[model samples]
Target: MQLANYLFFTTGCEQALAFYAACGLGEVTELKRYGRDGQPPTAAMEGKVMHARFEGPGVLFYASDNHDAEPMRGSAHILMLEDRGETARLFGQLAEGGTVTTPLGIQPWGDYYGKLTDRFGVQWMLNCRL
Candidate 1:
């Protein structure tokens, strides 16, 4: 298992992803545009971000547009991990004392990752690099 941190953006996911990339965070991978899929997206989500991934030294982050236009709140950044074994170990430890939002598995981005919030309400992200 490997893990990476995640951030959820409200609408301007593409811009945010580019900004972070410009900030020297890491190379942006899987920068997807919603309507670019060649499918008819909803009228409200024609050009939004369907998914985006970024990588930096010891950091991996993901983002997507909120289709509902709901406001993103709270501080829910994931704690990305580098090694699958380390991620699995950490997942077990955290789940033992918290809740798993997403079970570890092969994500659409072709990486193994998971999400969980510890007992203290702190969210964690685990990832295994592909």
Candidate 2:
């Protein structure tokens, strides 16, 4: 069985997408915009992301602009990296223009972990088993 993670961006898909891409999360593919398909979105939602996916090594991330839907309430996404250097780099990048709830450091479990909520209100758990 396969599982995928999806995010509903009420009004900030583009910004979040750009940020994730810049963080080297993965390649954004299959980006569909509103009005491209039947039942176009409202004017305010026009050109927004109807659906998008990010593909990386063993990763499948999905997101959409939920202009008409209820706003998302939480960030349930976590990213795990194997390399300490890469994890540190990404941790710093993700922390840019965001708040770090938990600073990156060695955990008692013999791993490195940190928590942050990005500017777009997406919480992230960065874990590295060094």
Candidate 3:
């Protein structure tokens, strides 16, 4: 079976996806804004991301907005990559405007690693083998 990461945003899933795209995180292959299929989008759901299928170099994930303001906890998505430059670039991009729990570095275990919480409060861990 193929595995994929799914993220739920309190709001701004669309904006988050845009930010991620700018950071080279991934692209949204398909996106559906929240709305009743039989009716035109209501004002409340007009700009909210209902679901988005995101795919990147070697990763796949789905994202959507909950619109209920609930907070997410107890999970951190890990990105394992082999290209040093892309890893570093993505780490820097994800770290912008967020808390860096661990600065990217060559760890004692000999892997380039880092941790951060993005502006949307999504935690991430990145490891690169170069």
Q: After superposition, how far is residue 63 of candidate 3 from its true place, in Å?
A: 0.8
Weakest lDDT window of 10 consecutive positions for candidate 1: 68-77
Top-TM-score candidate index: 2
* Residue pairs with backbone overlap in model 2: none
In candidate 1, position 118 carries an lDDT of 56
What is candidate 2's lDDT per residue for 49-102, written digit by digit as tens? Answer: 989988878668898898655533564567888999988999999889988999
Candidate 3: pairs in clash = none
lDDT per residue for candidate 3 within 1-130, as digits (tens), equals 9988788886778888898899887799988876643334557666677788998887689998875755557888899988888889999999889899999999999999999999888899999975
lDDT ranking, high to low: 3, 2, 1
Measured against the true structure, the TM-scores of the candidates, in listed sequence, are 0.50, 0.90, 0.87
Alpha-carbon runs more than 4 Å astray in model 1: 69-130
lDDT of 1 by residue, 38-130 (tens): 656777778887777888776677777766544434656655666787678767766665789899988999888998775434466777877
Report the C-alpha displacement of residue 74, candidate 2, in angstroms: 5.5
CA deviation > 4 Å runs, candidate 2: 68-75
lDDT of each: 0.69, 0.84, 0.84
